[model samples]
Target: MSRPAGPAPLLRRILQRGACAALVSGLLLVRQGRRDACSGAAPLNAISHWLWPESALRQCGLSARYTLVGAIIHWGASCFWSAIYEGHRQAGAPPPRARPPSRRPPAPASEVPSHDLVNALALSAIAAWVDLVLVPPRLSPGFERHLSDASLCRVYLAFGIGLAWGGARGRRAHRLPPGTRQLHVES
Candidate 1:
């Protein structure tokens, strides 16, 4: 099936991966927090613990204020990174070939570019650096407060994997299918 060639489809694809990346990374943060922190999801809640600075040091729960705010922040970052990745992929992608679909079935998620993982990982690494080193401590995700350096690396890795897996759900989107893209596209 031919997809409409325009900004609309492109935007949808980026959003799909963004939402997925946010979720995957957030979940891992929660899991790691539970394993290593005083409570569950503290790292996630710590993301927006600015209002309650002590939350990063001692508090750890699913409170709406901390968890909700943190989640939004994470989601926004994921989407932003996904957009950057999509744009880079678009710039480098070869023009579509004239031949019909090959005998081989579509790799799976036709909506997602075939070669994105490396780009996604590289982008995630940059994101991690910006978050940890450039962003002021108060504005940071607060993950480091609750996790070891090793665990922190895992969370970043999860973010990269999440960006890649976001579109892995299916290619039914764009044309509009019920999947991760549904979170980003109006179907």
Candidate 2:
């Protein structure tokens, strides 16, 4: 009997997720910077201000501090989403219903389509849409106030691309030696 392969190593998975989040968020920041710059505005300053208004941070008396705080918030959010996606992958595909008691082999890991890039892209898109349209206004007041629709679209696209790329990279890393099982056990 074959057991489904275990998920990738915890540290590796975390790194992959973190890297994806960083890339996506960094690119989004750059995109926002470019757009704001074209309009003769200081984009970084704008991001810092948007994240924490001057009134709110007035006591702190440091705009740079607010910018750092905003960066942390944005990247933390990206890592959070990446963790969610990785959790789903680790759980593997759901078992089919109503199987008779038998010694049938477990399905091969490759047969499970959950780790594929297309699925990642689809999941990212849905997650982005839901987060942007459904969750923000209810949970995060003024979250969308500083962002335009085009900027949001770019953000989503970057996230999807980053997710797919990270998943593909992790999958490649997790491929076992031809005769090995899971991590080290031999068949």
Candidate 3:
């Protein structure tokens, strides 16, 4: 039998990336909510200084200027990373679940992670480095302005989990029957 094509058609893959980005973006927002609970969503407002860069005070109230802009920025960033993750799969990091079943019984989830999860985490780490380290303070994610480093870690953790979960869900939804299992990924 012919091997199932990895991923999906070009158009579908693009859509999948968008879907993944949405999921990741939603997770990020959820994490942001925790910050909101502590600070009045000011973290969202802090992200953009287009209007009050010089002002010491930034107000966040779910207005178009604050939360909306932050959400959009977060979504776009998610999309960028999702595209890269999908591109890597298309470029031949064996599609997840395409690997042959392990002869030994599948290990507990905690013990083993599919390659896709590792990849997702790596991408997430890269994103954290870029957003927090490489990017200038002016360009840094606004949450940092209001959150402690511990809180930031939680946000990134949410991001990685979202990315992996989204990727896996997207893969399963598009999975075809009797696809080739020739691809071997060391779990």
Candidate 4:
């Protein structure tokens, strides 16, 4: 299947990923707050404190200020990831080539899932792992140190779902119409 010839516009990528990130992060924040309340733990703003330790924010009485800043940072990071996805996608686009018709039988329609969504979700999950597991230790966010394994799992789950949704939306936007020019077409 042929895809569009170039990367999507920067604005489109930003809009897709930024919106998804906002929604995911907002939900996680509310969920975390509720969990903390039920367990009678301190109210924690995980996202802000991850990038800027809660201790430091509280020391300056700037937790609220930095929360907004952290959110901007988070949304920016999401857009960055979206841009990377587009780069990989453009690079992976098949070059034009002559090919023989397939002798093998086509798989039934029911057996085929949308590859774009499958690939997006898979890649998003990988990205989430890198972000939640690998990066935290390297940076050693003080706020993250207090989080239980379950909380971290929830964070990754939310991020993965958001990434998949945004990516699939972007991919659908760029898809070529059926019966559009294929590699076999000649002028």
Please report the candidate that would top lDDT against the real structure. 1
Ranking by TM-score: 1, 3, 2, 4
- Give one digit per residue, the lDDT tens place, for model 3 in 44-65: 6665554446331256456776
TM-score (all chains, Cα) for each model: 0.79, 0.58, 0.66, 0.57
Model 4, global lDDT: 0.54
* lDDT tens digits by residue: candidate 1, 1-187: 4454789867777888888899888888888888889766688778776667775445576777878887887788789889888888789989766777468855554455646577677888998998899989877778788998888899898898888877665254434443535353334
What's the C-alpha lDDT at position 145 in model 3? 68
Quick one: how many clashes does candidate 3 have?
0
Q: Write the per-residue lDDT of candidate 2 for residues 30-126, one digit (tens) a residue.
A: 5664563332122323334445565322322224465455555556666676777777765885853555855875444334245456655776677
Model 2: what TM-score? 0.58
Q: How are the candidates ranked when ordered by lDDT, highest leading?
A: 1, 3, 2, 4
- Cα displacement (angstroms), candidate 1, residue 121, comes to 1.5
How well does candidate 1 score on lDDT at residue 108? 51
108-144 in candidate 4: lDDT tens per residue?
Answer: 4223135644655566567666665778553432234
What residue runs in model 4 are displaced by over 4 Å at the alpha carbon? 1-11, 37-46, 49-63, 95-114, 136-143, 171-187
| TM-score winner between candidates 2 and 3 | 3
Best by TM-score: 1
Better of 1 and 2 by lDDT: 1
